[model samples]
Target chain A: MNHALDTRHAALLLAPLTLLMLLFFLMPALSIVWTSVHGGQLDLAAYRELLTSALFRRVLATTFEISIEATALTLVIGYAIAMHLARLTPSARAVMMIFVMLPFWTSILVKSFAFTIVLGDAGLVNRAISWLFGTETPIPMLFNRVGVVLGMLNFLLPFMVLPVLGNLLAQDRTLQRAAETMGAGPVRIFLRITLPLSLPGVLSGVLMCLSLSVGSYITPALLGGRTDMMMANLVDFYTRQTLDWPAASAIAMVLLLITALIVVLLTRVRGGNVEVL
Target chain B: MHNSLPDRMTRFWRATGGLIAWSGYLFLLMPTLILVPVSLGGSQQLSFPPEQLSLALYEQFFTDPSWWGAALQSAKIATLSTMLTMLIAVPAAYALVRGDFPGRRFLNLFTLSPILVPVVVLGLGFYLNFNLFGIGGSDLSLVIAHTILIAPFVVVSVSAGLRQIDPALETVATIMGAGRATIFFRVVLPQIRDSLVVGALLAFLISFDEVVASYFVSGPSTMTLPVKMYSALRWEISPVIAAVSAMLTILSLVFSVALIHLQKKSRGH
Candidate 1:
């Protein structure tokens, strides 16, 4: 009857969610590891093949390459925008944040589809090009590495901006004033003080973007050429196309490990705050 | 006032920075905004400015069984999944917030681990596990998968809500001879109603937008709207798909505006 229950009552209260997670969430996730190892009685053949196969290795490399590219692109653009947003008055910021957050709230499918239209042959960019320069042929943008990165940036920018913006907003205003009083120019103060203070945010944003971009299946599959397949697509390839559960599970495990490694490294590098999530 | 070279250089840099940042904002917004006009295309081919504006795509979306049917199926699944996620998440949120127990930190991490795991991996895992149970493509399987996908968000939102309320409220209820159920329903629930609604909205939106996991677990009959759009995109480019995208974007916009309003209201309380 008391509000604060003993451990027994606490456990009872937690039982339903605990059971739900254990049965559906934990069991399904654990099955990936099981299938990865026990391909009919304790086999590591999938992992061995993954190590030996050029195609899998190439895909893994591409995943990291694309993720890094996307993360770098997102950070540059996101930092610029976050810098601008941080300087805005609160009322103006609220309005601007709607724009930043709207795309994030929308489905990734819708965003991808929009990118196809905006970057496709008869899309907006091509139309603008024709109108501007009288070009007859539209430049290809939608099915290459360019398109993949562009599509990814649309979804990833908000993740980067929000975090960096948080850190920027949290900075002491008097620090900048102090630096200015010391005859530091705006650029010098920003470079010496603001940039260093905001590195944790930039690091976390990089982490978020990289992890999301690495495990992304939709953007590359929709926008990239066949040569641009990432690890997630490889997982999908084995699962849907080839029906090789072990191979799929192996790639998934690798992805899981990469993501875990990123989290661990970033958190540690950021002085063990663990707030990257 | 001094017209100094350094001041002029600073102004120039500020202008350049604003231009770069505004361009980034434009890039962020362009894709979403482009869908609205394209969705109004009069022709069958997808294009910008649409050549001629019409509601034919919207008409198609409504009259066609595939589009509207998938919409209905998504709504149903999201509703059910939201309910299931809330049911499991609310009490666990209460336990995490109020009921002190060992391994609470572990429990918190476990609850949120699903969000950290890759969806593609979760999809395959769900496919394998559900196939083992012989319910791989059923609506039930999709619902369960979705609940797992969204339960973490519900837990986080509800737990935040629970944290906001004073513990003394519960003590007062207990002192007045109210049981746990009465204290929760009467004392705690009323205070956190706004956040409960927020959690439900978030769960519904997340479940509604989910595609990767549903793509694996759902059969042809059980395909949700996003999954249908995904397949449709892979196979062809139709104006109606544009309409679908526009509608979904609007849905997201509406939900987000509502969420922002609710969050402000909750925080005010």
Candidate 2:
């Protein structure tokens, strides 16, 4: 305690963690990129293989399509909940926060399993439907894009609510009060003032949702039909099925770049409204 | 004043907003708890509102060796990783909070960089790293991989704890002739012990629940609980998995509640 807080003291304190990161994290991550570049030699064959394959191209497209759909839906639903949360008193907010967090606490696999039953032909939804419509035939809902998207919808909703709620709380309330006093309509106030101010949360939440959906494997594999594959499945398939590290590394790099690109674009769009995420 | 147009409008929107918001929350929350009912189903098939309430599936989960092994393996990995993460993150977070040095900001970012990368990529990185050493299926491999992922949370929790402490306590101890190590052991650790306990628990829960990375690294012999459940889900619809899932969900819910409660109390102080 008597020692000065200097570079030497800091370095000493940081050594164990720094060494851990170097050995396990940085080396492994760099090695993947390094492997992708040096497939038997310093060449671009892996990238070329990925680029030339029509199947890989389609998988990329499908990944984005599903991710975008899930991200948009999550933002809308989560914004509604977060807005509600921001308006509540502390005790009420705490109760409502638990509801948002319940799915988050549960495993993603459990949610997928629940949907497998909920959306299956003989599952709960169809059972209810048959009861209402006077029919015994089970509706085929699982093993499709709808089920896949719904599974992801369950997983990402909390991620959306949390960041948006944080930004909404951190937001200045007097600005809205000022707008109210100035006779701005509620719709106008929301559109021009409140919504604009919550952009950082909205932007970050969307980015998180999109990235997660794109990389998701379990939902698509367990809930979706054969055709609904996301990028994570591609990575898993390459690494496990084909044992193609080079190809896997290439596709992974591509996926990471796409996520990075989207993140950069959104942060750019947020412009000068930098705030804590 | 009597209700104006704007007043009436606000009232209407408020009512509708509450309905939509509550429905969205229920929609997000209720699906996962489906396992609770299905887990109790007396029938062989997974179903809600069980044909009859029974502990048959729970019995199966309890008696099964594969299930037991996976659970044990998961617990072992989670414990080892959490301990290792604490060992590293305590000092790292301490340095970041209390020390003054060059590249401090960069070190902070480095600790948190894992959160930016997708789990699949990290899983792949770990898979490759371990494969080179022929430790791909070893417990050490799983522990190390999970340690890397869980360490960031430890740093965050400890740093939060660090912020909650009064620096004057450490400064006073320093002036009273306590050495740096003595101050850390006797003064600083006592103040942040809540964070250390809760942080370790959170890290344990995180490692226990992790699937994607565990899936990549775990082989047949070294499979963890989540990975085992994933395999069961993929291979067939086993009712036992429903029991396992229900149990996992409850455990996670309790752990999260405890962690959040601790965090709230810490901040309340």
Candidate 3:
């Protein structure tokens, strides 16, 4: 009876959360899949059309290209910054990390807006560029790939930095010292010892940056030109502007599927022995 | 020869590394610095190192009723969503961490999947669903959407805190004849209090900053600061928007500092 009561209490405690998960989270996602398939009857036409569309292909290619570049840039920069932080004293490390994370806490809208102020024509960068060059015309920086990439990197830098920092902090420093004592150069030691050991962090950061960059809507929409648009911007354009729910749902399902596949591929590459579950 | 070559390479890499590090810092800080002068511009246009410096934009933000009302609405929604997230996530996190349960893995995935899905996708789905229910353009819908969005952060934070605690401590308290309720209230809750506070703060910030979902679900009465700024941006590039953004930046910085301070204090404990 006591065991039964314990089970009952657990069930009661979990019921509300379970209900929310079912109704709000799982249901919405499944509904997207459902809506995509059954616009009128069971049909693969939406998927077929989306897959074949040249615009869709272009958007997909743009998404992958931008995400890959962003991921690579973030990993290299983030890894170096994490290494620098790791070498600092604890208090300094804390202060520096706080700086690194400041943008993460700020609104994405605010960050993107701030970028516009810096990157826009007559904005800071253009003003400075014109002043330096003694030119009358402000450089066109906004409404371009430069603005979108800058905005994305501003928001995403911390995501890259934090995971790498976590792994770096957890690493044993004595091994690097040992490698140095054995006449291993700093570059060699870093590449052979630190970098190899930090693969998990690098992998995680890359995955995060890729996933985030691919799905980001606000940054690209506000900053990017039509040619600079990502898949997420397309999804928003379809759903919000055109009121094309079925097409939007189809695109979303494809995005979700592609993201899942990437995660799977990443997990396998990282180590198939580790249980993703 | 190879030894000297390696040494030279190391020196080159170190210099390159330092340059990259400085660039990274500038990249992070430069955009934020640009907001200040733009906010203070006397002219209506957003120009850096404004031809004239004035506080009119700040005044506009403060004096305008709609701006203040939207700010208040954002605060209200953030508070309500934070509370809801904490209530739901704490118990769920505790169960997942401490209890043996079937489908716990699935439950964990369910909590995290929201983070994986594009915000626009979620926004569209919610818009469709909420419109059908007649709550599409309501504050209630915004709160619900935000709670779902932020609950995962609460769960992650609380779960991290739970992992640091020793389950044996709770077991010993129970063996010493403490009631289950007493053990939970006295032992478990106190141990995880820092994480709970951090989680709640994070949830508040996340909900406060959320724009995509807010844009879709919120009515004019329910417009958040970000949503308001976004709409304003579509129409014009104004110094007023800059002032509003600067205020938000300062607010976010203060909250982040407070969170970091709390984390440091807990670490010291």
Query: Between prediction 2 and prediction 3, which has the larger DockQ?
Result: 2
State which candidate has the highest DockQ.
1
Worst 10 residues of 3 chain A by lDDT: A1-10
* Tens digit per residue, CA lDDT, model 3, B13-98: 87788788778888787656667777887646777677788999989888998887888999999999998888887877877677
lDDT tens digits, residues A1-103, model 1?
4456668767887899899788887888789999998654678999999999999989988898889999999998999899999999987998888888877
Query: Candidate 3, clashing residue pairs?
Result: none
The candidate scoring highest on TM-score is 1
TM-score winner between candidates 1 and 2: 1
TM-score of chain B of 3: 0.93
Which candidate order results from sorting by DockQ in descending order? 1, 2, 3
| Candidate 1 structure quality by residue, lDDT tens digits, B27-50 | 988867788888888657888777
Cα-based lDDT at residue A257, candidate 3: 80
The CA lDDT at A224 in model 1 is 93
- Ranking 1 against 2 by lDDT, winner: 1
Q: What is the C-alpha DockQ of each candidate?
A: 0.64, 0.59, 0.47
Could you list the chain B TM-scores for each candidate?
0.95, 0.95, 0.93
Model 1 CA lDDT for position A163: 86
Candidate 1 Cα deviation (angstroms), residue B97: 1.4
| Candidate 3, CAPRI quality class derived from DockQ | acceptable
